[model samples]
Target: MEALKDYLPHSVEGKNILITGGTTGIGRATALLLARLGANVMITGLDEQHLKDALKDLYKEAKGEVYDVIADLSTEEGVNATFRTADSHFDKLDILINNAALPAGKVENGSYSEWQRVINTNLLAYTACTAQALERMKGDGHIVNIGSMSADVREETGSIYVATKSGIQGFSEALRKEVNKSGIKVTLIEPGAVDTDMQDQPTQEKKEKVENLEMLTADDIAISVLYCLSQPKRCDVVELKVRPHLQII
Candidate 1:
């Protein structure tokens, strides 16, 4: 097991970071890791109670400023509110982790409204947030998009989810080419199934399969984020894919 201290470093010290959906899963794990490493981090989530609880955990090890805002990233107002709140906390943004996403089970099984919600949350919000971050980042910044292997290894009943992940893969690539000249680095992290609350709603049999498969933990993805941030400004990790050794496709 890799300890949190092992991931800490002076490279990210005093850097201002903003992570969406930071109350849980990869976002929360990354927030905690960066906070421990001496970066001033502001995280946004939709749940107030979750935000409070995540803050409690963050305060325990955060060496730099830790702030959070409760805001939905699906709506324009929510997106604006998040950046407004972040701006008040930090003068300049060094990193933007677009980790907020909604998983959709099936295309045919869901209604149009449900489809819209999933697309807005998973795809549109990421681009909108990136645009906002680019404005605030000036000429130098790092944008890490948390994508999924589902984009490539598609499965039946996962059409909607796969569509969004696929969009992220393409978006990250095009955006990277557009921004790299400005000294901004863009990274896309595609990971196989991870053990998180996101998996709690699956069927018992499905959950059993995941448990047996030895899924990647939230910290595993966080370490990937840290690795991207730790690189020197002259170097950029364009895309990183991770999967549990036992995970098939």
Candidate 2:
């Protein structure tokens, strides 16, 4: 694979971006990259300490302004607060990265509350945030939805997670068509097993498989986000599916 620096472009300079779940993993990685590329960035997360620590790191390397909002996307109030924070931080938004998500075990193993948590964070929040962003965006804007390859592979214990991703795919498609005439572009990124805190609870067999296959890193997916945003306004990258070469599914 080519180095991420090789794909870096200056198209993102001066852009204002908001990323969900930016305290860690793919969202954090993307926020850092966009900051370095001169985009004003605001990230939202539920943890106060994590958000503070992430801001320190972001400010250290960011060429543009960096901000963080503490909000849990699982609730409607939290989702609304995030956009309010973004509006206060940036003059206008150029990109919205819907990367916040929660993983659930099996359908039968999880309770109604657990199912609602995953669904709200993974699927509902994405739509809600996009709607608010659309209202704030002027003529042109980009919406990047971070999905999962599980939507296609559909693992046995990933029913809830896969369902949310499938919904993301459908939502991205319909939203793209609905807003394309207004100069807003929608892109969905589906990534396979990424090495992040999200995988900390994997089973022994799953861990071994990830180690053997050499799973993709959070930065890998972040680079894909840059590529999507770097595209010309006339050309929209509809969907990008990235996976490790050794990954079977």
- For each candidate, the alpha-carbon lDDT, in order, equals 0.90, 0.89
Model 1: CA > 4 A from native: 1-8, 201-213
Clashing pairs for model 2 are: none
Candidate 1 residue-wise lDDT, 1-249, digit = tens:
545544447768999999999999999999999999899999999888889999999999999999988888889999999999988998889999999988788777989988898899999999999999999897889999999998899888789999999999999999999999998899999998787777655656545655676577799899999998887777789999999878866
lDDT by residue for model 2 (128-219), tens: 99999998889889999999998888898878888999999999999999999999999999999887777855666555666687588788
RMSD of each: 3.5, 3.3
Question: TM-scores of all models?
Answer: 0.92, 0.92
> How far out, in Å, is residue 197 in model 1?
1.5
